[model samples]
Target: MDVILFRFGNFPVTVLEAGLALGLFVVVAISVLLIVVLRQSRSRADAEIRASEHTHELEERISELLRTQSEMTGRMQTMAEVFGSRQSDMMRAVNERLDGMGQKLGQTMTDTTKHTNDGLRQLHERLAVIDRAQRTITDLSGQVVELQTILANKQTRGAFGQGRMEAIIQDALPATAFSFQQTLSTGVRPDCVVHLPNGAPPLVIDAKFPLEGYNLIRNAERPEEAKQAQAQFRRDVGKHVQDIRERYLIPGETQDTAFLFVPSESVFAEIHENFEDIIQKAHRARVVFVSPSLLLLSIQVVQSLLKDARMREQAHLIQAEVGKLMDDVNRLDERVRKLQTHFGQTSKDIDQILISTDKITKRGRNIEELDLGSLEELPSSERGNNQPTLLNPALKSVPAGE
Candidate 1:
């Protein structure tokens, strides 16, 4: 539709002109839109092509990556096999080493156990020996204690000395040479009396000794106490010597000298060393203090004297035996001479028989050479002469044994 519009200052406007201008504006706008659309489509197509090329390069790169992955897998499998074999070898070596160590450990343990057992056994044996030694020591200590108890009593100690003296006398001398606990004619008992050879008087031996004073002297600690003990010992020994002289001595029944028997050598030595005056006084009194050894020596001397006396008593018998032996030897010599003479006569007879046998053999050979016809023609006397003599006339004259 056409319409009237307001006019500008210089031109008049109509509805038909407005319409034509409006249509021309619409047509130009449409042309510009179309051109913009075409340009946009071309840009889209380039973008699509570029996208496709990039995708193709990506595909090729992915394929190469897959091939590399497959190679790596194969190498990994080979490496795994190598590692497995090495592990197996290492396991075998470890097992072998462990077994060797175990065997060595077992042997070492066995040796240690054996050594330990042997050491224990040896220790037990040593302990047993020690136990035996300890028991022996205990027994010895008990015996020593008993001996000490016995020595403590005065009467038992005296008996002990007397017993020892008796043992010595019995061992050394014949029973006929000694007497024990003999009572003398004076109604006094002596411990022993040894009979002497060759009509000598019997010797008296007294065994009682003063041991208390000696023990006191030895046990004294102070010098003054020791001096007092020594003086007491001297007095006791002098009194003992005096008693022996007075009690045992007789005019003609006992020997002029008597023996005082000391049981201990230590006491004897102590007296001899420290109490010389007591020994001198005993000697003057004809009393001798004798220890065990000295008593044994005196007994041996007495035995020798007795043996000498026995030899003297048998001297005539031994000489008579020797004279008889000489007579027997002379008779044997005469018998041997007679046997030699008979042997000589037998030799002469044998010689004569051999001579006669030679003559007979010669005559027998002469008879064997004679002729039988000649012997038959001969006279009786000549025939007898020609015949062989079977027995020899000279052989008849020979002795019967020859």
Candidate 2:
């Protein structure tokens, strides 16, 4: 296959030379390819070796991680157990504390309930008492209103005073000791007349009061009006005192001093305080202004005097009873002396009987030791004299051998 392809510049080229050149290029390409394959193979081998070493290291790390994870798991389990036990203990303690607190709360609530009930009961009782007190206050208010109504009317007010005086005298003195609305010797009727004991004149009590002028004095606001009202009150009271003295007093039938009974203590006090001249004039006229309390005191004195008089009248009866008691005591003493004499005679009789018993006892002893032969040895006169006076009839029939 030698053929001429091209000519070199200085030499002619043959087909054999072109063929050898191509063959040489092919050889060089083959060598280069072999070199490249060998280098790639060695690099691959080294990479495989490195990959195996890394895999071994990774396996070792995974095993170590597994061991550490197991240890952590065990520690976690231990911690869980410890926490569970602690939780159980805490739970038990909390339960116990809760139970105790519950009991205490229950007991406290019960005690509070009991105290609430007791307090409510006491409050109800107090309310009831307050209700009763309210009722009493209402009654008292009604009575006060009624009294005011009575005092507003002159006749009723006088009747009220007379009634009060009558009640006082009737309560303190017997019906015989006092008389109500009694006509005096002068033909004037007094509210009360108290008969004193032992020939003393009767005491007069007049219950007519001059309340209008006193009410005027109390109601006057201006000083000038008050002065006029006080003067009027003084005149009214002085006139009342004079009327009582003239109407009730008598020389021998009634006491020289007569009581002008004022129903109210306040009215009497007002008269004495604001009208001193009235009191002086009243005293000089043998007239006495007496309030309810003063009248009661005088009545009590009269009662005591009556009591003393009754006691004096009963003194002789008591003396007569004492004389009869002395006579009974003398009779008792004489009877006791007779009983003592009888007791002494009985004692002497008992002594003689005891002496006879001693002699009988001596005779019984002699009879007990006596033989039939000894009985025959005794004289008949001595035997008859020696026989016991107190021997039983059955013993008298007993044989000497027995």
Candidate 3:
């Protein structure tokens, strides 16, 4: 390596030269450093510019996001308001429907309760009526048992028959029209005697009927006992018929045709069915066997005959009343004729008065229709004159029918 030195005024030349060289070197180094620094500065400036551009892009993105968020928030608020309104409407509709259902259910329950009460009342009334009918049937059964016990005795049965005959006769005829337990010609006491009103013969009713043999036959368990009871019934009936014929068939006292009154219709039917020969014998003896119903019919016929006889006896009094009615009718007819004559005379007088009133009214109308203005046109002396020609002589002669 070669070394050189230089010197300048007031100092070493080599030093000055060295300084110059150093300055040169420094200048060169500075120029190099300036170039490196300028390159680094430009690089840094480029990096910073890229970073700022990136930051600017990010800020733009954030602003866009904020605007989008604001738009979304406003939309969400509107949707929430619409949803709340829809929810409120739905709740109100559901509440109204529930209220209506509740009211309808309440009314239906009340109506059903009332109907149940009415049905229960009607059922109670029907039960009460049925209970009353049950008691009535129980009492009727007891009465039937008592009646069966009473009819078991023969003497009591006879007395019962006699009493029934007396009651029936009294119901059919007046008390004076019938007699009970009357002795006949043969000393037989008949159950009933019916008096005829129109001079007819007395009717004798024998009520002593043989029911013991009939009852025995009815209650017989064996055929032989029933046959014997039937035979006894026939004998008893034959004897009773003979007695009726002997005692009641008096031609002068009672009717020639006598009645055998059996109080029980079942007993009379049994006799007719079982004892045909006895019925023939009774018929031959001029004795007619009559049941209670048949006897009542005969009594009704007797009562009607008696009523007809009584009406016949009062024929004179009825004729007298008819005569009095005819006299009253004739007197009323004469009075009506006199009243008609008076009406005719009054009508004639009213017609004459109406004719006179019509004539007076016509004359007064003619006098009122006279024109005073026309009369005033005449002389005043003529209006004041009382002469017939001065007043209106034409009104003095009115027509006859005016």
Candidate 4:
């Protein structure tokens, strides 16, 4: 078989055959080269497609990361805003509390200072009065010695008893309630007389007590002397009781019962403890015994009774005053009603005056913008008086206090 199938015009036929072989060889080489190029291009295109897919995946992941970062940034901003607002509120509350505490502290300090100053001033005043009190104590000691001397004498003792009784009576009753040494119709003078309410019988209080016999009984050394002293005390008390009953116990002039005041509580106690029989005899004789304390208590009861009687006597006067008070209250109510009526009238007049004033003010403002020549040129019918005449409600009517 021949290698070349055809040939062109050639100088040598062998060269032409060789050229066709070379051309066929060259065409085969070109086909191989094109196939290699196509394979390389396919591989490169596959690599490019994989790179593009990977790049797309990377872009998506980057976008997601960016989006998460943006969301996180927004949350941080919101959290920051909330924290800032909370901090502001906390600071404001703390400031307000501090202000309140400061005010309270200042007030407490001021009060404490005032109290401390008052205490210091009182302390100085009390110290200044101490010297005067010491001088008064020395004078009181001398008065006590003089009082002891006054109690030693018989006549002075009687006068002292009367004076003490008068003092107790004065302390308990009014000056008009009791009388000193009142004389009865029988030409007998009592130590003191009490005038009672409702024409009750006057009570006579005898200040002379049988304390001398009691003193003898208490001071006796021998038992026979004590017995003798005790008997004398009984006789002395019985005679005194008889004398009071005969002189002071007149039926119409005084109460049937008279009080024998034991000026010394010790003497009164000794008589009651040892001489119960004597007390019974005095009771039978219509004579009552009283210690100073008992006498004061009796006077207090009398004073209370006097107070009640005085109130009963003035009952009509209190009722009249109460009636006057009620009439004044009624008159005050009537005056208040009249005042309310006056106030209502004043309010209504004031409202009408306000309306007139507002209309006048509007007309005044309008007049300021007007031309005088134009106003003069205007027809009298067209130039209506818009300015309202204001009236004072207070001038028309006035309210007076009740």
Alpha-carbon TM-score of each model against the true structure: 0.65, 0.66, 0.55, 0.49
CA shift of 400, model 3, Å: 44
The 10-residue segment of model 4 with minimum total lDDT is 393-402
Candidate 4: lDDT of 55? 54
Q: Which candidate is the best by lDDT?
A: 1
lDDT of 3 by residue, 274-367 (tens): 6889899999999999988988899999999888988998998999999999999999999999999999999999999998898888888888
Screening candidate 2 with a backbone cut-off below 3 angstroms (N, C-alpha, C), the clashing residue pairs are: none
Q: For residues 132-247, write the lDDT of model 1, one tens digit per residue.
A: 99999999999888866777788988988999899989999999999998999989999999999999999999998878788788889999999999989889989999998999
lDDT of 1: 0.82
Q: Residues 229-284, candidate 4: write the lDDT tens digits.
A: 99998999999998998999998768999988888787788889999989999999
- In model 4, which residue pairs have backbone atoms overlapping below 3 Å? none
Tell me each candidate's RMSD, in Å, in order.
Answer: 24.5, 22.8, 27.1, 36.8
For all candidates, the clash counts are: 0, 0, 6, 0
**What's the residue-level lDDT of 203 in candidate 4?**
89
Off by over 4 Å in 1: 1-105, 196-203, 249-257, 297-315, 371-402
lDDT of 2 by residue, 173-262 (tens): 888899888887779898888999988999988898889888887889999998899888878888888888777888989999999999
TM-score of 1: 0.65
Q: State which candidate, 2 or 4, has the greater TM-score.
A: 2
